[model samples]
Target chain A: MDPSQVDVPPLKDLTIDNITDNVKLINSGCPDPRLKYLLERLVQHMHDFARETRLSHNEWMTAIQFLTSVGQICTDVRQEFILLSDILGLSLLVDSIDHPKPASSTEGTVLGPFHTHDAPPEPNGTQIAHDPAGEPCLVLCTVKDTEGKPIEGVKIDIWETDSSGKYDVQYEGREAPDQRAVMTSDAEGIFWFKAIVPVPYPIPNDGPVGKLLTLLKRHCYRPSHMHFMMEKEGFDHLITALYLRGDPYETSDAVFGVKESLLIDLGKVSAGQAKTYGVKEGGKLMSYDFVLVSEKESRELREKNAMYAMKDLGLRMKLYNGLPIPEVD
Target chain B: MDPSQVDVPPLKDLTIDNITDNVKLINSGCPDPRLKYLLERLVQHMHDFARETRLSHNEWMTAIQFLTSVGQICTDVRQEFILLSDILGLSLLVDSIDHPKPASSTEGTVLGPFHTHDAPPEPNGTQIAHDPAGEPCLVLCTVKDTEGKPIEGVKIDIWETDSSGKYDVQYEGREAPDQRAVMTSDAEGIFWFKAIVPVPYPIPNDGPVGKLLTLLKRHCYRPSHMHFMMEKEGFDHLITALYLRGDPYETSDAVFGVKESLLIDLGKVSAGQAKTYGVKEGGKLMSYDFVLVSEKESRELREKNAMYAMKDLGLRMKLYNGLPIPEVD
Candidate 1:
């Protein structure tokens, strides 16, 4: 044993009951308090879960193999781990924990695996739907603060699936980006672009996560939606999506990413109105005003919510353990 | 939504508190009961762990990346996930759960990442060590049942690290096996071989698991030990190792794999006996009688223990949740 590890108590004759404590004790030597806390609680839950389930050796090996496959499948353009996290509802849970917002502000969601930094900058009203797979729609969106005041110059990166239910990145040997673009809000906090109506699509399921979903008998399709990643100075960057209200998968998005506030209805725009945007006739118009929280407000909310979340968790644990929940007063 | 999914109620407008239930509900459609049970508990613990720690976005991403790297570093011969599980004490827990035995049987330990099926078969009394880095040692062993009767023709696979604390597999472009062999017990249920004195070795640490141990201020060395995997018809197969009695890392095996029953003290053999075994004058000797449990008995013990474990776990959970623990009849 190294001299640096002398502080960690020696672990010997480990049984099911004492193993977690010994592991945590060994991990207690970490220099960072936050990291130490995370490790301790992580070991606690992992061990407890194993014991509660009385997990068998075969099951554990299966989990190991599944995880290995997930890691092996990742490439420069793909992130299978994030996909696993999303299907498990973990990605959204973490996002919610970190990005609590006011009721009026747009709720954040899972930044699915398809976003890219190379989205070409386009002028307002430029057609982003290079592929003719679906009906044309003109997106008219505005960025605002909680006070409903326009916040100009916000860079919004937008991407979505075509009618075939696949992102441009999903195609093999794809030469150019389609149905995606980066656009900036005008001085009036408004940005509009021509795009195809987004369609419901299955996440990449040829990997282990896909196999898991199939075995779980769960569909892999997410509701038709347009992804938006907005960034501007002095405000919190937002990763969100606007789901079509009438989509069949709206109520049961495979990833559990749906939030009621992010749903929007599409309206018809006449040929004359559509022509003003330089798109073909009989196009649909989608409009929404997204509210961005200031970075200061986001930080304060995160801290406050973290405290509340821990307290609430402690109370649940107390109740579950048969201990009395503390009085709020 | 597919017609088959009508049984799974739609999940809408998910909140943090309700997402777990929704995820479980969707997963309830899995046809395999055992798999369904495993997934339920897995999600329960994973979510509870995240919530209890109030796991941050940064931390979650860190975990994802860590797992990815662990997966990516693996090769045909290297199993990093097993190493991760060993360090977390999960591998031992699962092993204990699946292979419960009578008190008289030899205890089992981790089957580490280094074992290979390609170990060349060697005759009894042959020297298995091809590397000159370690001191010569004579190993004498016998296989027996709980009733004290000898069990013949037991296949024993033996392996150990050289004095430099490296396995033959650890070296790049290695051509042949060294310090490892497969031998079978004779008609008298006895097997003898000449080998090297095993020494403590750190697990492969150039990867993420190593970095994690370093960050946690934990040593990565396992106590010097000789590996053994024994098998014979109609008896339980055993995977175990014998640790040296006074190895410096005995008490703090980085993987939490040490158990008292498996420790042994080495003894020296006289020059005459060493010559009989065809080893040098100063060679050490290791001797032990291994006991095997019948397959039927092992199956029974596992079933009985599994019931007790689940019952105990249920009681603990009930108490923790403030519910009354069930009375034993």
Candidate 2:
């Protein structure tokens, strides 16, 4: 034995009881306090989960391979990881935690993989579905503050799948985008648009997320719904969706985006009543009122802005540090 | 109001307390009981971790992007996901749990990312290092069963980094593989090889795992050590390494592959003592004896074999089911 090395300590053997602490120690040097805290908790939970499951080495390797496939399948137009998060109900959980809405305001859901920044703006009552193949539905929506007062000029960005349950992006060789529009509320905070009744649609199922759902023996269909992102200068932005009543998948949306307040009745209207809104006979008229919450205080607004600025700076640093540019929208 | 649709149940709101249950419910349809159990525990821990950290939307997105990058960077030659697991101390934890050694047997560690099937076989006492780069070290190891009797004819596969801490794979244009050899134990269960003193080396640091280590302010160097895989019929395979005592990183291996019993003294030997092993002048010698556990009862072995067969069938089904081929090794 070498005397110089005789003083070396024996390796601290790791066990189920000690593994969490060992991992925590490994992450103790994280420079950012928040990052450190997150990693520590993450390590703890991950180990606990593994132990609780008695995860075999083979199972763990399978998980690693699954996640790798999820990442590799992602493209400029697709985000399989985000889809995994959605189906796992993580997306909604995060959204709910981040944006706790008052009872008077609209409930939020996931910003499912479809939102785009360059939505075409059109006047109120414009027909969003250029060539409708489903029942004509007239959407009459009113935007209001918590006090029930009108909050005019709020931007309401909307998008949905067509009668065939396909987004414009899903179609090949499509000439123009359909089933989407951006419109602003009027002086009365009332907005209306002509669109087909959005049908229940399966999320992109050819990817790893779909395979996971299949393996889990779960359906991949989301309830028929219209996605909406309502925003204004002072109010908090709301990313939510209105699930149509009577949709079979309403009770079990694969992405779990459903909420009581977000469900609406698409009641049938008389031909005369439909004509009043420029809809053809036998059309449906659905009326919804979205309530927004005003900014709480100047200091709170300033803090929020600062947080966003910090996030932007961190993102820039990550980019400058040679991190891969994420293709997320 | 649409009376026909009035019977739908109210959406089950998800709170921090209920998010875990919601995710569990989503996975309730999984046919495999083991998979269902694992996913339930995994979902619970993941949600708890996120909630405990109060992870913000931006931070969550950042994590997703990080994992995506890790998956994207993996290739047949590299496994960024495994590297991530190693740095997080998960790989060792799993290995320790899966392979609990008896008190008399040698402890096991991580296989690491460096093991290859193309290692050249050599005769006993063969010099693995073709040229002089560092101080010569002769490794003499014996294989045995738990009874302490010699177990000959066991394959002993070995590999390590050169004196400069560079593996043969890391070199741009290597003339031949270095610091690696495969040999079998003789009648006395003894095997010997000559090679340069293995030096501590940093893991591949150009990938996302390296970037993560940097972000965590953690070093990426593993302690200087050797790799070994000893296997024979009717006995468990042992994948482990011998850590060099007194190495600076011994106490803080980046991959946490160190164990006290696995640590040994590389004692300096006199020229006279070295001549017996064909070493020139001053040299070092390391003597290690690996004891493997015998296979359990026939019932246990049969059960294990059946479980593995089921896993193989599942994997084949997954492939035939149109899941993307994973690019990870």
Candidate 3:
């Protein structure tokens, strides 16, 4: 049929109330049902947002320009859009939805932009921080399955900011993989490392996102935390962080990455007591136990369980329409 | 007060249900009340949209990438963001809201990307289309006040596509300002020009916006029309178009610029009959009359009237907060 000749109802003049439906109708031809659904909802909500706010033309233009700058500033190493998402708390929301953990297991958080796959593997108890000015600290972690069985030989990736709250990647003259290390758990599912106690610090604030934060009169600080990525042969890979309980920004982490289960106490240790854990005097000690859900159970829970049954229903609708299903991973 | 010492309430873990409130609280410090309201509303609606669609991480990433590409491709001559907005019907929606015309006045449409301020002025009946292949067209227009009194000495900027559905800007070898002309209405508020009968043309489809249209199984064609920017003393400047009735894409204009009042008949004139208007034989004739509201009424209607009282209220709030209010013009 000649689409142009088909008697389409004449569109009413553009209005706040009708614009959403009009845009949805325009996107009705999208072959990808998922994209169509996403776009329709986006248009509906965006139009509603604009109307509800009584957004001026200038405000809308400002948003367009801001988004443009964000896109223009993105590079291989820098993703301003992702940063925007993270600071907006969208990244963490997505993380939680995609990786709902059982009550017995550790919760996941955003895999922040700084994770690198090239950290050198070190034996247990190796010092990951070389900065002598940083306060010495000892971290011990044990990985176990939901049944409380130790998951030995799991590869654990660990990284943390320096005591000054700056990651190695943020330094202009830092060596490769500083303040980061990879290790395999021992027979007892125990992995320990010596490092500096990280301090809360502001995120990079020199770009457009920074300018927006300043305009909002908002601080850009993230709480002190240690990042961990643990993987075992038969368990779901866990990417999370353990934040220091008493950190100044613990209750207000900029990225909303903090979870009650992920907070740990940083116990101050005497010089002689620190020496027992192979750390220098006046250091801190932290011990955490991470529980992983089995891969089979995790997959089944996401695909067939009631927690995500709505998503499953959506996927089934897509399949019924003979559209290609997008890979969740 | 020491911000860090101030006891902030513990944040709930990020979830779909609470992400909106969380983001709103994060933006609570926004000194500019207008920006805060807009951003808060944006966050709420965007979060709601994400949840309503059960948007997957992959789909979200795809959207970010798509927006990034749109921003990267924009240049001085090309505005992909505007194109995106236009294709989605947002530009027209904004225009309609910002420039609400009374029923007696000619409605405004999009100020399309092709408008240039450098169009050379010519006397009435000047032949604007230099292309010999184009069918001759005679445009006769009258400008008037809302009461039908002729308003003389109005500058009318006119432009349109050639018979081949290509604008001068779209042609690599075209002369400067071809197919465009500026003219002034005479003492009687009468204006006339000779040009080609414009053909429906596809918008530039080589960019990300075009790709999006294709993915949506939608066409990018706009109906045959002549753009006009009419300005005179004591009246609001008007940016609008007169679409040729019976055009193939008149009902399906990709930009949603068509209005029932803007459609006009193009009566074919024989060579002998065309001499009356000083046009060559085998041309089309279109007579349109535009009515303009007084500037006083327009301003008062937009500001003090209930239709836009909410926007005025918002403006007052911005003023009270000492934020620079955006210029309505």
Candidate 4:
């Protein structure tokens, strides 16, 4: 619908209090109802924010320039906007809303900006860390349904920061993946991998987001954790991370990704204990059980929140289809 | 302050209801009170927007990508974010709040992204448009205070879209400015100039902002208008534009920059009438008086709204100093 063709009661002398109403009126011509709803909500919130804060002209320009810089710094590998969202806790909120889980199922967290699709497939119990200097650790996990029936062949992509507190992708001129691997559960619905004990690390702070954190007087570190992205047929996909207990930054994970249930202790394992896990040397043991939600149940929960989920399905298709997937050599 | 050093009551198992509170809590360490207030207000609005609309992860990512593109497309001359702000009516809202005026004073509007300081200065009553093919238009204006006493030496920067509905900067490989100039009030506190009648035109629509307008099913044309930026030492700086009466886009300006008081009729004039204004041929006549608020009175109003104005003073100094002024050769 052309704006001139749309009927509007002549909008004149638009005052501060009236402009938002006029904006909503002008946007009433939007063709998509979901887009309309989303835009209306957005307008309400943003306008209210400006009015409540009594945002000055100069301050608004400062924000404009800041957001512009945040955008300009993005590349195929770096996503400053996502980092901004993470630090603001928006990323976690979105995850909680879009992927609600019952207490019986393991909770989910942010899939921090470091996940890569090129992680090499490794056999069960294989050492994922290539660096011999990193403190050795063993992860033991089983995948099962809410009813406790073991579900085999679950695809898992696990990655973590090295002891030096950085992912492989964080290094320049990176060739192959380290401290990360892709594997599947065995017949007994059990999967295990040997890797370095992950360490707490700061997010990329060389960008505007980093500057904002400094301005906020907030630290940039996430608690030490290992990331997991899991999927299996007839089950809901899960993206989560396990925070190590007693990490200094645990209570203040910069991205607000920590969940109480997701915290686990890395027990000190003696050589005899390591031998049971088929390792020759002493190492840390990280053990936990993973729970899955059936696809049908997940769909039912989404239907319960059908207002959002209905639009979400279409958005998912369009987003992934239209989005540019960065080229990885 | 370091994350480990801040005293935070162990935040665990953060749900949607509590995450916002926790975010504000974590950010409470921000040393600047004004910034803290702004961030708190911003977080409240944004979080409420998400929760109220049930924003999905896919939708959030779409916004992230869109904003990134808007930022990526900006250049030395193009400010896509400002255009975005204009179309959303945010620019106008900010102007209204920051530059509130007495009914007698000329109201300010958005400084639409076409302004350039390099506009060559012209003598009063001289022609601004270089193109001979354009329909000549004579502008007559006086700068006066609330008492109707003429004020001399008010510097005015005037610019408008050409007869082809584009700014001089819009043209590819443009060397010098046309349809724009800088001038000052004459001895009688009056200034007159000859220029082409500006035509309604679309803002830069090849960017994300344009796509958003199309998605909203709205036309992109602003009403034909001439922009004016005036500054006099003892008066409040005024940035405004005069909208022509009866323009097709008048009722639905793409940027919402129109006010009833700012609209004027461009009366047809004979060659005889044009000669009186110093134009040699028959053209259109635009006659109006611009009223300016004294600096003292403006400051009083701001002081009345001191909650914002106090911060604005510091922001003005920092914004101009820190902002990169786009260079024009």
Model 1 lDDT, residue A242, Cα: 94
B291-318 per-residue lDDT for model 3 (tens digits): 8877767655544342354564464322
Q: Between which residue pairs do clashes occur in model 2?
A: A11-B260
Clashing pairs in 4: none
**Candidate 4 lDDT, A1-329, residue by residue in tens:** 35557665466678778989888888877877667767877887777667655667889989999999999998766788999989888989888877778789999998878888889888898989877778888888988899998888999999988878888888888888888899898888788989888888899988899999989988898889999988998998888989999998888888999998999988766677677778745568888899989877875675455444434433222221222111220
Candidate 3 accuracy as lDDT: 0.75
Model 3 quality (TM-score): 0.80
Candidate 1 Cα misplacement greater than 4 A, ranges: A1-6, A315-329, B1-6, B315-329
Top-scoring candidate (lDDT)? 1
Candidate 2 docking: what grade? acceptable
Model 1: pairs clashing at backbone N, Cα or C within 3 Å? A320-B320, A320-B321, A321-B320, A321-B321
Q: Report the C-alpha lDDT of model 1 over A1-329, residue by residue, as the tens digit.
A: 36444565877788877899899888887876666767877788778877766676767888988889999998766889999999888888878877788787889998888887788999898888877658888898899988889998999999988889888888889788888899999889999998888888889988899899888888888999999999998898899999999888888787888888899888887777766777656668888999999988887777666667767665432221111222331
In model 2, the runs with Cα more than 4 Å from the true position are A1-12, A118-136, A171-182, A267-281, A284-286, A295-329, B1-12, B117-136, B168-182, B268-281, B297-329
Of 1 and 4, the candidate ahead on TM-score is: 1
Q: Give the share of true interchain contacts found in each model.
A: 0.65, 0.44, 0.41, 0.61
Give the per-residue lDDT of model 1 (tens digit) for B1-329.
35345465777777778888888888888876666766777788888777766676777889988999999988877889999999888888777766776899998888888888889888899888866767888898899999989988899999888888888889989788888899998887899998888898899999999998888888888999999999888887788899999988889898888899999988888778766777666668888899999988987786666567767665432221111222331
For candidate 4, what is the TM-score? 0.88
DockQ of each: 0.49, 0.27, 0.35, 0.38
**Per-model B-chain TM-score:** 0.91, 0.80, 0.82, 0.87
Q: Pick the candidate with the highest TM-score.
A: 1
Alpha carbon deviation, residue B67, candidate 4 (Å): 1.3
User: What interface RMSD does each of the candidate structures achieve?
Assistant: 4.5, 9.5, 4.4, 6.3
